[model samples]
Structures are given as structure tokens and as C-alpha cells.
Target chain A: MTIYENKYRITYEAFSKFSAKLSKANDKAELLEIVQKHLKYFFNFKYFRVLLKDEVFLKSFHVFHNSNNSPEFILNEFFSYEEDLLKNHIPIQHSSNGEFLNNYDQKLNLNNGKLWAWYFKYQDLQLCVSLISDDEKPFIVRDIEILNLLIDSFVTKYQQIKLKNRLHQKNVNLKNAINVIEEQKFQISKIVYNQKNTIEQRTKKLKDQNSKLAEISRLNAHNVREPLSRILGLLEIAELYEEKDLKKEIFEKIKTSAKDLDHILQDIIYKSNNAIEKLSSKTPPTK
Target chain B: MMPDKIKIFLVDDQKIANFITQKLLQTSNIDCEVLAFDQPIQALDAVEKDLPNFIFLDLNMPKLNGWQFLEQMQKNITSKVIILTSSSDPADVEKAKDFPQVISYQTKPPSREILQELILG
Candidate 1:
């Protein structure tokens, strides 16, 4: 088999194993282990790290086949390069810098190269993916293309897996919401039981208050009208007199007092009408 | 029988506007006999007896709006019609373009200079 055919078979077999593990994997740790295993075997990188764009600290696991020395220096260099790439219009791959520009270098870095870096782009995230390998075989351009295709597939697969997890969580949340609603329904009767006595007490108190206020208002209106009627009647008689100057003065006084009383009565009537109108609009008119 | 002077007819509903326009025409260097009319129908009747050289008409009125008055007056008299009104509406502004007799549309109580210019220019 050609190198491509070999790599394809290896990647396919590993993905099959990972797909099986992905179904049963409960936590991130189990999922990560399966992921690391498949990624290491298939992509053949010295170091492999998955840095979530949302995370403050990058989360990655590395495996070096040839050397015991860790590729921590390579990651430090990559962090600045990644920031620059995002800020400027620079592409991912820089030959001098310890990173991969396109998808191919990522696989090359993992397999046999001493230094390699890659980034996976999504809607709201940029994953700084990298690998370090020390091998005689130079990274071929065709292999890089295949690697680019492979990572793209991986990103799609990753999204699908995450969506499935979200759906599962959503089902659990819906179940919890239903349970809470059922519990609330059971407790709702008790709330109604408690509110009934309080409502009755409040209603009785309000009625008593309303009656007392009405009685006071009636008494106040009676007291006001008696004096006002006497003044108004005298003014009306003075208005009918033959003397124009005297008649005008009394007429003006009576007009002012009469207007004040009319205003007060109209205001009370208007307020009552407004209240009734509001209540009627809210409640469907019963035929 | 009439004096040797150019007679100008002012047609507008606003008495003050007509008064001001009359004053401007009187003070203007252009020697003209100015007659003011608050009622457009009365003005139309007066114009038939002796048509003036210029007729300043207010665009908006109660009985007969300036446009209709101009149409009726145009049928009878050969006076140069000029629209004068406080209305800044585009429709009213565009009235001058449609009416061939209308020399210009002046925004209310036009300056004495502009009034003189309208009559002489």
C-alpha cells in the first residue's frame, strides 16, 4: 500500500475504535484518553495538544517517541505566533517558526518532525493544534494536504459529538423541569389553602374601610352644601336686582363658587368612570 | 378717464397681508396704482372692468383659493398673475410652474425689493 493508503487505513481503524469509545465515554477524561490514543496512532505526532479556545490555560497531552525531552519551548513560541496570526493577516504555517501553516504540517509534526504547529478554525474559536517529532523523513506536501483534510474531518466530528452531548444534557434538563413543575403543582394546593383565609380577611377589612370612607365623604358633602347653598341663593337674588354694578359683583362671586363645586363633583365622577372603564376593558363584556 | 399709472390688483384673504403688500407697492420706485381685495370674488369682478398689469394672489383662501381665482380671472382678464401665500407646501410652491400666467410664487408679504422686481423685472 502507498503511504496515503496506509495512513487512511490506520486513521479509519482508529476512528472506528474512537467512535465506539465516544458512545460509552461518560466524562471528558475518558473521552480525552480515547481521543489521545487515536490521534497519536493515526496522525503520528511527537506531541499532541487540544487547546479549547474558551479555556484560560491550554489543555494538551504529549507523547514523544524518539526523545524524553518535552516540547514546552515549541508551545511558548506557538502562543505568540498564534496571537500574531489572529491580529495580522498571517496564515497558520511559518517554516522558520515551530508551527504548521496548513493542515499537512500538523500530521507531519506529530509523526516524525521535531517541530510543528497547527490551528483549527471554527465560528468562535481558534484551536492551537501542534505536534513535535524528530525523524529523518521530511514532511511531504501531499501528506500535509491529506492531514489538512483529516483535521477538517476531525473538527466536523468534534462538533457532532459536542452537539450530541448538548442534546443529552437538554433532555436531562427537560426531565428536571417537568419534575419541578409536578412538585410545584402538588404544593400549589397548599398555597391556595393558605391564601384563602388571608384573602377573606383582607376583603372584609377593605369593605369596612370603603363603607367608612363613603360615610365620611357623604357627611363632608352635606356639611359643604348647606353653607354653599345659602351663599349661592343670596348671590342669585342680588344678581336679579336692577343695579348693574351690584348685580355684576354678586354674579361673579356666585359663578366662582359654583364653578369650584362643579369641578369637585365632575372630578369625582370622572375618576369613577375611568376606574369602571379600565375594569370593563380588561374583562370581556358579559351579554 | 383713469390716471396714467400702472394699476396692480392684490387678491388675498388676510387683510394685514393685503395691507402690507399695498404699502410695499406704494413705496416701491415702480410707479403703480395698487388696489387691495380681501374677497377673491370681488377682486375678480373688479378685474373684469379694467384689467391691471399685475395681480398678486394668495394661494390659500376660504371661498375661492388662489389657483381657482387665477383660473377664473385668466378666462376674463389678461393680467400677469403672481401667487403670494404663507403656505410652504411643495404642492402650492409647484403651482407657479403649472400656471403660465403666474410670473412667480412669493412667500407671504414678499420683500419690497422682490415685489418691485416682480412688477418691473
Candidate 2:
């Protein structure tokens, strides 16, 4: 192999190792640890940051390379340099320790800074990636492809976690909706059951009224009218016989019928007065 | 033929009602043998044994109403039946139309005109 081909093969091997470690990371904390451990092999930077945004959330992740370092994950916070890259969709640079560069100052950190930033998008995810480096540890143009590949793995893991959380939320919402429908069904059946009971009670009341009406009709037809009709018949037949014969036959029968009619009328009046009193005593009538 | 000796049956739940009908027929000078019964069961028995030329029946009674007695007599009833009820209810008159054996509907005590038409007519 030529010397140039051999140099490219070593770079490719280093990238593959870093990419495999990033893919194995299970969570955000693990992913950040893997990135901090493996990123130096791909490129040199004094500081690294990526601003990620989807439809609902905007996040910024940062890593400082001052030997005593940890990645910072901030929500809805961004630098002006990142804001400029996001809007312009252009690569930006600040030559020496400008406001755009990272400001991590300690006695052990001995580098003047230069800033480089770029805006890129993958599917629905918008990315603003920035790096700070100095003259001693330079971020070269040749390492851009390696950095892009690492970012791809990181963004993939983030999307997977977000999608899982959204699916869980959807399951919880579906359960609540189903419970509401079941409760409504139960309430409707209870109302129907109550209405059915009311109908039965009304039918019973109607039956009672029919029987009471039948009894009144029977008493009127037989007891009240029988004697009156008999008296009228006896009086009619009296024209056929002599006044002397009627004095023996018809007069006694007429007196008997009149007495029966008087007694039945008295009984009817007493019953009607009692019924009226009973009705007036109560507000709502009982069955 | 013994046409003058017509067998008349008075079947009323009330004894006084039957008595009134019999005396009214007697006072009207009709020549017929009148049989009266307050108990409807005894009337049915007498009717089955010797069919009356005319039957005067009341609508309401205990144990066996006029409708139920008519249903029993529906097998071979040939005698004309007159409904003799004190009830002024037109419903009874309307219901009596269902029985072809029931020839006339009358409210009691029946007027002398009704008896003349039913028996002598």
C-alpha cells in the first residue's frame, strides 16, 4: 500500500471504534460519557457543544476538554454563536478568544481560543454544532467527516429515547379515554333501569283505578237501581187493578221499595264523604 | 197445541227482582206458567231439563255471571233470552249483541210494553 492509503486506513479504524462505542450507549448519561472518552481520537477541540431541537423541545449539550471535565445538558438555553449558525445555516468562525469561544478559565487550562460553528439538519432534527480550539490543539478541516458520523450516532440515540417516551404517553391517554366511555355506559344503563321501575309503578296504579271504577259501577247498577225500577213497575201495574186491590197488593210493595232506595242512598253518601276526607288528608296520593 | 201454556223462566240473582217480574206478568193478565229462580245454578238445571219458551236473565250475579251462563248454554240453547238488568249502562246492551240466543235487551223492572213485545209479539 502507498503511505497515503495507510494513513487513511488508520483514521477509518479510529472512527469505527468510536462509532461502535457510541452505538452501545444505552442512555443520555452513558452516551455523553462515551462521547467524552472517544471524541479526542477523531478531532482535537478545547470545547464542544451541540444545540439540538425538534418540534417540542430545544436542548444544548456541552463538553469541556480541560482534563477535569463533564458534559453539560441544558434545556432551552443557547449561545449567540449557535443562534447565528441556526438562522444563517452557515459555518462561522471567531479567530481568537472572541465572545463566540468557550469561557472555561482555570490554572490548568492554558490555551487561547478560536471558535468554529456549523448548522445542519437530519430528518426532523435541527443541529447547531460548535467547537473551540487554540493554536496548540487545532480543529482541522480533514476531521469534519469523522465528527459528522459521531453526531449521526448521537442524534439517532436521542430520537429513539424520545419516540419511546411518546409511545408510553399515548398508551396512558388511551387507557383514560376507555375508562371514561365505560363510566358513561354504566350511567346510561342505570337511568334506563330507573325508568323501567317507574313504568311498572304507573301500571300498578292504573290497574288499581280500573278495579275501583268497576266496583262503583256494579254497586250503582244492581243495588241503587233495582228497587227504584221495581217501584216504577209496581206503580205502572196498579192501573190494571182496583184501588182497593192495590191498597192490599201494590201499596205495601211500594213502601218496601222506597225504604230500600232510601237506605242505599244513605249508604252511598256516607262512603263518598269518607273517601273525600281520605283524599284531602294526603298531598301526593299513595298507590 | 198447548200454545196458551207458555213456559216462561225468570232468572235473576235477586229474589225480589224475580218476584217483581212474575207479579207484573200476572197483573198484565198474561196466560203463561211462570217459573222464577234467584239462584242461577238452579235456573240452569231447570232450563236444561225443560227448555223455556222465553228466558229472562240478569247480567250480574255471584259465582256465575250472565256471560258465563250463556257460554255454558251455548251448546244447544234454542230458547230466546231477554236481558233483564237494572243497569242503565249501554255497555251491557252493546255486549248482549254477541249472543244470538239473546233476542232482546231490557232494563228492569221491564216496562209492560217490553214484555208484550217479547212474549206476545
Candidate 3:
């Protein structure tokens, strides 16, 4: 096989392997690790870094960097360049002696290197990948094409992971809503049960009062009538009698019967007043 | 035809009531042998020995009420009973209809006209 054909075959084989690994990634951290490994194998650079902003938590980020003998690149130092890159969706390149190198802290070894950085939107997230090389040869058009292909896979995997997380959050929210509704239903039923008990107790008390009133009525009919009847009988008999002595005896009986009737009336009044006082003194129960 | 010298029994718990009833009957000059009793049990015992032609019964009593006396008297006697009660309550009047031996129900102080009609009828 020709050298160019061999190179193409190797690139295709590596891309297939990287895609398999990315599909198996469960979350952002795992996907970032797989991306870093694949990028390092495809393009050997002095420095490599990836910065991914979370879709849900805007201020949070996942950063993956190649740590093989490369000088530490503090993410905070390059934050100034993010706004311009995010707006344009364009790549920024810097040669070894470019003025752009001056923007970073001098401690970083980016001073004698060629830097390439791209910022783009993937689904609901902002993704940025940077490559720095100290070699004399500048990046060719073919290198950019392979980098873009790898970045496309990274964006797809990230979208899948973010969609899954959002769906899980929606499920949790739905569960909480159902639980709240159930609790409210239980409270309402308990209130109804308590109200039923209150009604039953009140009905029983009323029934007792009704029976007492009925007894009072019975006493009025029987006991009260007994004395009144005797008075009436004596008066009728006095009308028929001719002798003053017999009439005087009938008057005496009439007086006794009248007093007995008066006593019955007073007893009825006393009992009724007591019932009224007892009812008035009672207080209703609180909720 | 009205029977001459009708044997009448008067039963009540109150002694004053019996005295007044006996005096009213005696003053009326009816041709009847009136036997008055303050206790219902004594009246019931007298009834078993010699059943009166007519009985005037009072409902409320301590030992035995008018209903119990009527129930006992009905077992052997065929005498007519007139319920004379102080209670003019409709329930008591209605209850008097249950006794087969009861001929009439009357409230206290039965008028001379009513007594004369009962004796003549």
C-alpha cells in the first residue's frame, strides 16, 4: 500500500475505535477522558486541553488536559479570550512569536510554541479545545479536518449525556409532585373524619335533651292534671250540696288540690331552668 | 231496663279521691251499693270474691295500676269497667280501648249528668 493510503487507513481505524469508546462513556467526565486519549494518539502535541461548560449549571465546567511533561496551563488565565471566541464560533491561531502569547502569564511555556484554539456551541453547551505544539512544522489543512471530525463526535456524546441528565431531573420533579398531592389528599380525609365524629356526638347530646323534655311533658300531663282534676271535682260537688257544713268541707278540699297543682308548676319551672343553665354553661370544642 | 240496687266498685290510690267520689255518689241518691277502696290490690281481692256489676278504675297507683287490675279482673269477671283518670292525655284514653272489659274512659270530676247516664244506660 502507498504511504498516503496507509496513513488514511490508520486514521480511519483510530476514528472507529475512538467512536466505540465514546459511545460507551456514561457521563461528561468519562467522555472527556476518552476524547483526551484519542486526541493525544491522533495528534502528538506539546500541550492539549479541553474545556466544556455544563448545559444545566452554567458556571460549572469539565476540563481535560494532556499531562505528559507539559507545563501547567491554568484555565483562569485564558478566561479573557472566551467572550470573543464564543460569539464568533471561529478558531484562533498563534505562531511561535505572535503578540497573542503576551496575553498569558509568563510562567506558562506557550512563549515558544504554535497555538490553535476553537470555541463552538454543541447542543446547549459551549465547548473549547486548544492545541499547542513546539515543533517547526505549522498545522496543515488535513490536521484541522481531523480535529473537526473528532470534535463532532465529542459534541454528539456530550448532547446524549446532557439529555439523559435533564430527563432524570424531570422524573425526580414529577415524583415529588405526586407525593405532595397524596399528602394533601390524606389531610383532607382526616379532616372529614373528624367532622363526622363531631356531628355524631352532637346528635347524641340532642337526643338526650329531647328525651328529658319528653319526660317533663309527661309529668305535666299526669302529675299536674291529678291535682287540677280534684279541684274541679270538689267545685262540682259543692254546687250540688245544700248544707253550709258540706260546702265548707268541699272548699277545704279545693284549696288543697290548688296548692298541689301550684307545687307541680313550680317543679316543672325549676327543672326547665336547670336544663337551660346546663346547656348555656357548656362551651363548644375547638378544631 | 236499668237494674235496681246496682253493685259498684270504686278503686283509687288517693284516700281523698275515694272519699270525695263516695260522697258524690251518696249525695246523688243513686240506688247502688258503692264499695270504695284506696288500694287497688284490696279492690282486686274484693272483686275476686264478689264481682261488682260496675267498676270505676283510676289509672295511676303505687302497687298495681288500673291496666294491671283490669288484666287480672278480665280473667274471671264479665263486669263493665269505666276508666276514671286525672290524666286527660290522648295516649291514656287510647290505651283504654285495648281492654275488652272497659266500657268507657272519663277524665276526673265526671259530671252528675254523665254518671246518671252511665247508671241509666
Candidate 4:
């Protein structure tokens, strides 16, 4: 509606476009470096610094900035009222007269040329923006709004890059675990196959031994009876001279033993014949 | 009661087996005279001199097997033979019947019942 309002709206639109330019990144270091470049180029700010306090319960802060040199804040004064300031739980960006601000200015010899600061409530850390124009009174309100806009966009980009790095590392670890498991499975299957082959070989060997034992037993039984039968028969005839009455009983007993010899011979013949039959069957039928 | 004059012959390749069988024969006929032979040839050679009425023979042997000895003894003596062995073969039984003098076949240290019937039946 008004010219000043129109100019403010245009600046806001430009800042909004810079904020919307956040993209997925691979690492935290690269994301922070890009945010430093964006503050210098997009916002046209001479100096910008971001001090991030460790969110994992460590009371230390990491500062990323356009300048490589550390700020001249006295360590004791900076930490003196830090606890109470953090516990207040409100955005400290609007506090131009806070204890930390006065302490920081005194330590840095700062006369304030467009110095702006914002302390994010979520992270107890400060974002400092300055025009670096000496001898000019600081445009604190206007620059603080600009610094807040830049910090918002930077935080969003940092989070995006951190999430990307975590997901990428997780994917790599998962793939390595799967490869290890698959190799183990392959080795186990090979062992099982070898064991099965060994069992089959042992079974075949036992069967062969059993068949050989059977053959030996049969051969042994065959050879023992003939001489025994002959002896008994001769004894029977011999008994006629010594014991005439016992001759008949000896004859009957000899007859019974002869029958046993006959039975064993028949069994040997049957077994040998069966062995021959099996051997013939195993031989591929000749035309 | 077997007569003391009844000559009993023991035959086998293994010396221990021959000794055990000879001992068993002594228990049965207290007065019988027992003669042990390790080789088939030696037994066949003394068949006439020994004139044993009761002859125990083993079939599995080195030079002359029981079957060969039986054939040889058939020509020399009318002695009765009883096969003593650790075997149980049907082929052996069939061969035993082939010899007319082979009257009975007895298995190892022949069972008391079988020996009692053969000697005292």
C-alpha cells in the first residue's frame, strides 16, 4: 500500500526465496560451509557467525563463520550468566541490553555498527550478524529480523544434510551385514553336502563287508562235515566187535549225524546258487 | 564207557583247537587213547599204524584239505570219520554225503547231546 511497505515486502520476498533454496546434502561440514557462503552472498552481510551448542548433553559450543579467527569474548563472562539465560526458555534475539550482549561487546571492543544477534530457543546458541561499517550507528532491529530469517533457512538446510548422511551410512552398513550372512549360508550348505556324501560311502562299505562275511561263513560250514560223518560210520562198524548190544544205538546215532551233514551241504549249495544269480542280474543283460 | 584200547584221532590246522578237542574226547571215553595231528598228511600217513576207530577232521587246511585227506584215507583205511569244524556251509554238507565212509558231521567241540548220542546211544 505504501512505498516503504512495498520495499519491505520486496526484501522479504528475496529473503524468502533464499530460504526456500535448501537442498539435500551429503555431510554436516559441507552444509555448514554452504550456509556461511549464503549469508555473505544472499543477505549482503559483511560478517555472520553461528555458534552451535552440542545438543547431546555436552556443554560446549561449535562456531562456524566467514572469519577463521575466534571472537574475543572473555571465557568467564560468557559462561557466568549462560545457565540462567538458557533456562529462561525464550528467544534471546530481541535482548539488546542482556548480560551476554554487554559482556560480548566489552570483550570484542565492539562499538556496534549494524550488529544483530538471535538466540534460538530450541538450541541454546547464538547467531550474530553485523554490517561491519565502522563509525555508523548499528541498525539493530532491521538487521536482527534479517539475521533471524537467514538463521531459520540455515538450520533447516543443516538438518536436511544430517538426515541424509545418517540414512546413507545406515544403507551401507545394512548391505555389508547381508553380504556376510549370505557367505556363511553358502559355507554351511557345502558342509552338509560333504557330510551326506560321506554317509553314503560308509553305507556302501558296510554292505560290501556284510556280503563278504556271509560268503566266508558259508565256505567254512561246507568243509567241516564230510570227515565227521565218515568217522561216525566207521566207529559204528567198529563197535560191533567191542559192544555188540551197543552197535544198534551207535548205528542210529551215526545215522542222525549223517542227516545233519546232509542239511548243511544243501544250505551251502543254495547260498552259492543265489550268489551266482545276483551276480548275473547285476551284469548288464547281454544280447 | 569207551574201551581204553579204542584209538581216538584229533585233526585240525590250529594247534589249540586240536588240543581242546582232544581234551573233550578224553572226558567222554576215560580209557580211550587220544592222538592229535596238526597236519592232514601226517594223519593220513599214520592212519594204518594208528588204526583209530574214531577220527575227527578239519576241512579248511593248507596243503591237503579234509576232502582230499578223506579221499586218500578211503583208499588206506576203513576208519570212521566225523568232521569237526567252525563252519556252517551247505556245499560242505553236500560233499560230505559223496563219501560213503563219511558217516556223521559234528560241529566244534561237538555239543554234549550230539556227542553223547554218537558215543553212548
TM-score of chain A taken by itself, candidate 4? 0.56
Error of 1 at A263 (Å): 52
Report the TM-score of candidate 3, chain A only. Answer: 0.74
lDDT tens digits, residues A1-287, model 4? 99756756876776665555455444555555455445443443333444444343322222322354433322222332344344553433321222244423233333433333345644543432223322323333454566666667666675666567778889999999889889988999999999999999989876996889677665544454444534444453443344765556445545655665677677777877897798789779988
The C-alpha TM-scores of every prediction are: 0.35, 0.60, 0.76, 0.45
Q: What tens digits encode model 1's per-residue C-alpha lDDT throughout B16-52?
A: 5565566567766878888999999999899999788
Instruction: Return the TM-score for candidate 4, rounded to 2 decimals.
Output: 0.45
Per-residue lDDT over A76-115 for candidate 1, one digit per residue giving the tens place of the 0 to 100 score: 2335655654456344533332344343234333333454
Best by DockQ: 3
For model 2, which pairs clash? Answer: none
lDDT of model 3 at position A102: 48
In model 3, which regions exceed 4 Å deviation? Answer: A1-26, A33-47, A54-90, A95-113, A122-124, A133-139, A149-153, A156-160, A243-246, A284-287, B1-4, B19-30, B71-74, B88-98, B111-121
Q: How far is candidate 1 from the true structure (C-alpha RMSD, Å)?
A: 27.5
Ranking, lDDT, top scorer first: 2, 3, 1, 4
State residue A52's C-alpha deviation in candidate 4, in Å: 2.7
- Which one is best on lDDT? 2
Tens digits of per-residue lDDT, candidate 4, B58-85, equal 8888999899989888876877888877
Q: Which candidate do you rate higher for lDDT, 2 or 4?
A: 2
Q: In terms of TM-score, how similar is model 2 to the real structure?
A: 0.60
DockQ of each: 0.00, 0.43, 0.58, 0.04
The prediction achieving the highest TM-score against the true structure is 3
* Chain B TM-score, candidates in order: 0.91, 0.93, 0.92, 0.88
